[model samples]
Target: MPQRIRKLIGTVLLLLLVVVWALSAMALAQGRVTELGWFLQLVCYVLLGALWIIPGGLLIRWMERPDQKV
Candidate 1:
């Protein structure tokens, strides 16, 4: 894979993850925010955060491959 392509793919994946996380966080602000509810939402957020590592790691590894040349 080319370095430019790898960087583009990595950037797109990171952007996708950011969009997902932002949307998930924004879902909390519609109406009637609560303490316990927020806590649970935070737990869910953490879970999702952890789940992101797999793809994130893959993207990073792809971008970092020594064979890729820009």
Candidate 2:
């Protein structure tokens, strides 16, 4: 597939991923993280904040890939 197409798709997917991640994270925070002590809550928030980078990075890498030669 073309790089342009890959980027377009990846952009959409990345946005969707972020939305879903944020919603789920918020739910988790409201449900359980809020009940935890301050230090544990901080750790959970930090981990949840950074966890989305893994898939987002992969999608961005795919988006930036050189187009396959015919």
Candidate 3:
């Protein structure tokens, strides 16, 4: 992938992760975990954390390079 596209994908993934985290927090706070939504919410939380780790790290590294323009 081109550098620009890769950066865009990474940024999007990171933002999605953040949104997922927020939704998960809201669901938990609203006591949705004990309901039928628990399974989906659990999966979402897991994926959210995972997505943020690898892609977010790569994006940060890419953005940090002196030669690259975001």
TM-score top scorer: 2
C-alpha lDDT score of every prediction, in listed order: 0.72, 0.97, 0.66
Clashing pairs in 3: none
For model 1, the local distance difference test gives 0.72
Q: What shift in Å separates residue 16 of candidate 1 from its native position after superposition?
A: 1.9
**Shift of residue 4 alpha carbon in model 1, Å:** 2.8
User: lDDT tens digits, residues 7-47, model 3?
Assistant: 67767777986788677766765575446476787785676
Residue 31 of candidate 1: its Cα lDDT?
34
Tens digits of per-residue lDDT for model 1, 1-70: 7777888888998889878866765575443344457687677667655766777788788888776345
Summarize candidate 2's per-residue lDDT along 1-70 as a digit string, tens digits. 9999999999999999999999999989999888899999999999999999999999999999998888
| Segments of candidate 2 deviating more than 4 angstroms | none
Q: Would you give me the overall lDDT of model 3?
A: 0.66
Model 3 residue 1 lDDT score: 46
**TM-score to native of every candidate shown:** 0.54, 0.97, 0.44
Total clashing residue pairs per candidate? 0, 0, 0
Return the clash pairs for model 2, or none: none
Ranked by lDDT from best down, the candidates are 2, 1, 3
